[model samples]
Target chain A: MPKQMSRHSTVLKSPRRQAGKPRPHSGEPTHGPLTAEELQLAVRNHSMPLEALRKDTTPPGLHYVLTHFDIPFIDTDHWHLQIGGAVQRSLELSFRALLRAPSITIPVTLECAGNGRSLLRPRPLSQPWVLEAVGTAVWTGVPLAYLLTQAGVEDDAVEVLFSGVDTGVQGGVRQQFARSLPIEEALRPDVVLAYRMNGAELPPQHGYPLRLVVPGWYGMASVKWLSSIKVLTRPYDGFQQAVAYRYQEDADDAGTPVTWMKVRSLMVPPGVPDFFSRSRILPPGPVLLTGRAWSGQGAVQRVDVGIDGKWAPAHLEHPPAPFAWCAWSMPWVADPGEHEVSCRATDASGAVQPLEPVWNYQGMGNNVVQRIKVTVGQ
Target chain B: MPKQMSRHSTVLKSPRRQAGKPRPHSGEPTHGPLTAEELQLAVRNHSMPLEALRKDTTPPGLHYVLTHFDIPFIDTDHWHLQIGGAVQRSLELSFRALLRAPSITIPVTLECAGNGRSLLRPRPLSQPWVLEAVGTAVWTGVPLAYLLTQAGVEDDAVEVLFSGVDTGVQGGVRQQFARSLPIEEALRPDVVLAYRMNGAELPPQHGYPLRLVVPGWYGMASVKWLSSIKVLTRPYDGFQQAVAYRYQEDADDAGTPVTWMKVRSLMVPPGVPDFFSRSRILPPGPVLLTGRAWSGQGAVQRVDVGIDGKWAPAHLEHPPAPFAWCAWSMPWVADPGEHEVSCRATDASGAVQPLEPVWNYQGMGNNVVQRIKVTVGQ
Candidate 1:
């Protein structure tokens, strides 16, 4: 027998801990401090390393991934995407059949709705993400609109619900991961049912055989591990759709649903990084600073690079596609001192990253400006 | 502008924390608790979920990854692996040339030296991993001995240093990631310079174009993003070699070098899991309990299933390869009650997992038995 296991220093001291009592999941926020449960979630679900911001389309493995439940393994041969509900004709398409359909490839950036949650003053007690919960990839698939038109949606259908094979208990409800999109949004030509990511078969972590690629929306809207689609005559209110991924001010508020991503930008930490602190240290010289920025509303109209607290407009390049992130750069002759480097993006619709993090019940849509600490040596 | 920023509950409360101080990294034990810096590393480098144990070969994305610095991107067309130092013939092999060399495919189980670091009474102030830092994969590559023999090693050569392109600062010293092996271990037939994993090009996070795969050794022995190899007449004392990854009793002790993984076993957590606690729930019935057991010293000899601390012998199967993990199973008839399910492994070398975690300065090799909490519902 292992000598009585006992060592959770933080959990023992935390006033919020219930100690052995299994609590049901809820939308309540932790008043202060991160918990052991949140730490477990943070380590299980990871964020993209900001260093990867150097690439255009994030290499598949480096792309950020989030699964509400465990990744469900799919045998391509045995998989069939069933499409039914209010449609005039139900359809079941195999992996090969979907690949043979009209294929279109495009670069799309996906950001998790809870990206900067850790940056919030009262950290959410879920995945305590600190930026980096975003990535861009080239996806190849059939236009979701094409499939919907083929099925001939009935006139009364108001929304389309997507159900993923991955299942788990959340808020005491055991159900498949499911979410819905209004009829108009589901009919967008660029919305895709993707089978491939960055020219490779979708990796299991990113939802193997098939998944929905909702361009311009936060990652939660782009469900993974696709199993079925149902055209609903009434609005869908599943656990994921109604109980989470919302912009709530308090527990009593039926917060507005989180949809398109807010404007955001991230800089590659400059110079050599410390193994633990990740603080940058480099000899003084002319250094090129670069990063990626984007928004779900539209193209990024401008990006500003800030040194310390002063801001300067940076050179921005057009993206490969309307929904993809754009590259931005600025040259700086760094002085010998400690400094903070940050970047902020403003989309065509004028949405910009908040200079400081905003607190919310579930900690969603926290597109706060990124700040990296660095030291320039002689 | 958003607002003034503030929050770090644990960092602020811990008496050991030095606010705003840029301290040099060291092997000093963090005698009491995990730190904010360790939490940062924990989330960046993830572990495989316990549920993934159900599979034979872990899916690539689910494989554990630990990068001390950044993942360097390699261009396959231009990359050449340089081989030099105490050798009669120096060689530089291109990616294409190496691919055409004699190939061998083998399944290897790799576990991190610090897999159970967080379990220590006083946690090591680095990536605070639990018991999930392990995975088995089928790797295809050219035999390392075949390449070493072709290059012709000199009689006086004592060790071989492997250099990876990833560069970072550790203990305030900046250098590329490097490690070495004794001449005898370097000439093993199964040691390989791998190019493919699970029949596909190694993903970027796992070291894209090329990497060294030393089967049966800890993952640190298999350098990722490998670029150069140098045969040495004397021991190499790089930071990674001399300072990190040592099994030290205290800072002053010239600790034994950490090498092969210790014996360990983990069960695939059965039934539905609570999203936060991960406590299991299942209907009462006859259930088959299964998991994987592996050791670098040799094959796993025995696996014992422990129900509420009572031990029972389990059925074991031969592994796919000598270096791969072996499967073990036991049948359990559950009643309507709560229980703690655990498993313990003993390797061919007669080394068995410790019942309780042993504390160390660097928190290396703490392979204590694994336990899971479950509830059998009516």
Candidate 2:
């Protein structure tokens, strides 16, 4: 009498496959089977695949998920996060009023409103996401200026709005996706609201019950399925703070004045080894030449790493947290086939990393200069 | 004897449901039921589900597909396209010289390069894409300034590149995506190279043996699996023109710009008879609100529509051909219950549509002011 377990046919599966092969879950496995150094640190896209560590920390099922619409639950006793337009006390909060306030943590990295759009030169309509998007995590919460000074804001406010319980269908309209920040960067003091991650409690796909960890920027300005903020003395026409998070022409001309531009990234710079080009050539000894450096603005002073164009001083490693991401490495000595290795960085405010940036019809602030092309042999 | 031929396994199946309620393909198509004029366009994702005489003009397989790194197949005598750096006549051609040049067709619409990041707001990682990304077609080819004047671009070039034969593994960077445009939007003239599409001949998931068709922008500038192009005097730092079609900070900074902004859209403001928070109440008199009006920049020319905020006047049509999409409409007069119904447009260079627009980071060009909500009774 114990053999009646029939519930495995929920139906609907057509992800399509036989029209030229390759399409079963289109590269399936949203998790599992990694390790080649955990697939090069979960090759970005929400980061944390480095083999589910435990001490160097990173396991929350390998943190780094970043979603928006799909994963939305919200009934934590009728959820709340409100805040209110232009402020002067329009509060709301609850998730136990932001877990009883005064909290903190850090270690950021988010990225992806499209990440390396499969190297778009003219290919932009979308999706080709070259870098899996990106990730890092740690997080925690509270601070949004201690709840925007317990909702006091006003003084010609300027914009804060966040809103989310996720709902979509844009273009055909039916929106609800929202965003907005500048109330002095939402009263910074390390702007947060996150409900903890990496140390636990905030997992129903990374925005569990609350979110808004804006440290530097990118990661679509960190807003996840949050709920509401509003403060604006102007600038809040919703539908994602007025026509879905904007950007306008000029990386080469779609026109300009679309605004929002600054704080660029994409690094590699260090010493330049693995076949550093002049057309490749490497075969004499030890090498490493690693990469990765980030920023929304400030902190990252000096990274260099060149090869057939000079410079290679090296020596930096402060980032384990603080909007996280620093990893440098640079040790060389070779000489056989073909090369080119370049890298660059300089932020702390000085900003450098351009061989050509500033073109905006939406190729938004691309740091530039980071080439590679190894070949070396015996 | 023809009955002995039964080999349909081809694998794909699965859309049949009933046991646990997993249905969601609601792109509706019933038939074993429904007959009040087939329940009026049977609405769901394209709407109509009631009205009359819309005689299915391109609604069969439900149009709009868009793929990208998938769908390859080349070999048109080794495919080809090339073009070359700094130019002065480098050319490559093949695919029978891109089907013997001089073509034109028109029709346009393409979309998807992450079309409206699943309606952002705070949910911005990406790909929940409900508008299935748009389509229209009619393509054909040539132009791109006659292949940059048959690859003779010099005069201090200023970027062009394209290269595609698609490759993958982005973050660990096996790389190959490629993109670039600059040189006056790659010699505009509505940019081309397409190889045909609504007039057939392309579909290997669209991009068959050649592709490019830029038209106005977005569609990742239109590159598909094309091969090469190069030209540059400036922009083309690769990685999709420097870290994937970007967008960034500023817009007063609540933050979003991962890249590409401005030229918003979304005014599906017609006959909305449903959806309310501020508008809809029609049905007992005369109606017609209809929607859709585009503009990555230029060409919409008047769409207006309103109800409670009062305005009306709409009417735009004519765009099923060049760069496609125009469609507006307006005629309200029922007035009963809820009502807020908005819609704005104006283009042909006068710009307009902005009850609010200036937040950027990566919700690329989201035209604002589009509302809808309905409820009328006796």
DockQ of each: 0.43, 0.01
Cα misplacement distance, residue A352 of candidate 1 (Å): 1.1
lDDT of 1 by residue, B1-378 (tens): 001111111012212323433222444555554566776786678888777888898878778889888877789888899999999999999999998999999999999988888777666678878889999989999888898899999999999999999898887788899999888889999999899999989988898788899887789999999899999999998878777876666554455567777778999888877676677888899999999999877579999999999999899999999889999999999889999999999987767887888677777777899999999988
* Total residue pair clashes for candidate 2: 98
Q: What is the lDDT of residue A40 in candidate 1?
A: 70
Which runs in model 1 stand beyond 4 Å of their true positions?
Answer: A1-28, A31-33, B1-28, B31-34
lDDT by residue for model 2 (B1-378), tens: 011111111121323323432111121222122221111111101211111112112221123333322334466886777778788778787888778788777766556544433333442332223222444456778887877886677898886878777554222233567788767767878778887665656744455677787765667668776888788888765545544444433122221112221233344433332111112333556776666555545566777776778786687787665456667667667657766677777655556655643333344444456555656545
- Provide the TM-score for each candidate, comma-separated: 0.92, 0.30
B327 Cα displacement, candidate 2 (Å): 3.0
Report RMSD for candidate 1.
Answer: 9.5
RMSD values for the candidates in order, in angstroms, are: 9.5, 22.5
Best by DockQ: 1
lDDT of 2 by residue, A1-378 (tens): 011111111121223222332110112212232212111111112322211211223434333343433345456898877878777879776798678888989877655544433233542332223322445678788888888887788788887878777663333355556778767777878878888876667755566778887865766667776888888888765544433333433222212111222233333222212110112233557776665565656667777777766878556577786566676667878576556667677766666666543322233334456465656566
